[model samples]
Target: MAIALNTLVEEAERYLNASRIQDYCPNGLQVEGRPQVSRIVSGVTASQALLDAAVEAEADVVLVHHGYFWKGEDPRVVGMKQRRLKTLLSHDISLLAYHLPLDVHPEVGNNVQLARQLDIVVEGPLDPENPRTVGLVGSLVEPMTASDFARKVRIVLGREPLLVEGPQMIRRVGWCTGGGQSYIDQAIAAGVDLYLTGEASEQTFHSARENGISFIAAGHHATERYGIQALGDYLARRFALEHLFIDCPNPV
Candidate 1:
C-alpha cells in the first residue's frame, strides 16, 4: 500500500512530537518530492551521494537524520545544496528528516538503540529538566572492565571504537550517538563512569583523561544508522509501504 506524504508526515510528527523541541533544522519534511510514497530510502545524511542512491533505487521518499536548511546555513539555493535539491526534485523523491527527535525517542532513538545493543539499561535522561537532552544515563546488565565494554561497542557498531579507560569497572554509562562529544562533562557530572559518543576532537581525549571518566568514540555514521533504519522499518510495517535503508559511508 502506498502512503500519502501528508499522512506520513502527520504520523511522524505525532510519533516524535518534533515541533515541541527546538532543533537546528526544520524537522519533518524539508523537501517535497512526490505526492504519493510507496518506497522509502533512509540514510544518515541527505548528501549528494545519498540522493543519487535514492534516485537509482527509485525511492518515493528519502528519510534522513541530517536534512538541509540547517540554522546558519546559506538559505540561497547554490552549490552543493542546489545540486542535492535538484536531484531529489528531479527524481520526485520526498525528503523527511528528524534530528534531535530521532536521537531521543525512547524506542527508535539512536541512544536507546545503542544502549540496547550494549545491554545498557537506561535509568533516565542525563539532564533531568531538559526533555531534548541528547545524552542518557544507564547501567550495564553486569559489571565489566572498561576494555571489555569497549570491545563490545566496537563489535556491535562494526567499527573500531576509540577508548579511554577510567578507574572503575564500567557499570553505569552515559551515551549520545552522533557527534555529541561535548556532552562528556554532563556524564561526568551525572556520576557515570563511562561516556560514549560518535566523532571525537583532540580535546575529547584530554577531557576523558582529566575528568576521571572513560570515553569511547564509535564512528558517528555507524552508531547513528540504527535509529532511522528502525524507524523506517516501523513505518513500512505500519503503513504497509516499501522501505530501503540506503547507507552512505562516512568516516568521520
Candidate 2:
C-alpha cells in the first residue's frame, strides 16, 4: 500500500519526537517529491551514491540518518549539494532525514542497536544529568578482557576496531555511535572500564591510556548503518510500504 508523503513524514516525526530535540540539520522531510510514496530506500547518509542507488531501485522516497544543510554549511545550491539535490528533484524522489532524533531513540537508536548487537545490557544514560544525552552507559552480559571485547566488536561490526587497552576486564561500558570519541571524559567520570565510539582523534588515545579506560574506534559508517535500517523496517511494517536498505560501505 502507498502512503502520502505528508503522512509518512508526520508519522516519523511523531515517532522520533523530532521537534523536542535540537539538531544540526532539519529532522524531517528535506525534499518533497511525489505526493504518494510506495517504496523507500534507506541508508546511513543521503550521498550522491545512495541517491543514485535509490533512483536505480525506482524508490519513491529516500530515507536516511544524515541529510544536507548543516548549521554552518553553505546554503547555496552548488557543487556537491547542487548535484545531490538535482538527482532527487529530477527523479521525483523524496528525501527524509533524521539526525539527533535517530541517534537518541530508545528502541531503534544507533547506540541501543549497537549495544544489542554486541550483547550489552543498557544500564542508563551516560550523562544522567542531561535528559537528552545521546550516549549510553551499559554492561556486557559477561565481563571480558579489553582485547577480547575488541575481538567481539570486530566480529559483530564486520570491521576491525582500533583498541586502546586499559583495564584487564571490561565490566561497565559507555558508548555512543558515530564520532562520539569526545564522550570519553564522561565515560571516565562514570567510572566505566571501557568506552566505545565510531571515530577517534589524535588526543583520544592519550585520554584513554592516561585515564585507564579501554577505548575502541569502530568504523562510523559500520556503526551507524543499523539505526536507519531499523527505522525503515519499522516504517514499512507500520505503513505497509515496501522498504529497501542500500549499503554504500565506507571505511571511515
Pick the TM-score winner: 2
Q: Which ten residues in a row are the worst by lDDT in model 1?
A: 126-135
Off by over 4 Å in 2: none
For model 2, where is the 10-residue window of minimal lDDT?
A: 125-134
| List of clashing residue pairs for candidate 2 | none
Error of 2 at 10 (Å): 0.4
Q: Residue by residue across 1-252, what tens digits does model 1's lDDT show?
A: 887899999998999888988889999999897799899999999989999998889899999999989899888999998899899888888999999999999899988988888899999998787665788999988999999998998788778889989888888999999989988878888999899999889999899999888999998898899999989998898899998998888877
Residue 227 accuracy (lDDT) in model 1 = 92
Query: Per-residue lDDT for 202-248 in model 2, tens only?
Result: 99999999998899999899889989999999999999999999999
Tell me the deviation in Å of residue 248 in model 2: 0.4
Q: Please tell me which predicted candidate would have the highest lDDT against the true structure.
A: 2
RMSD of 2: 0.8
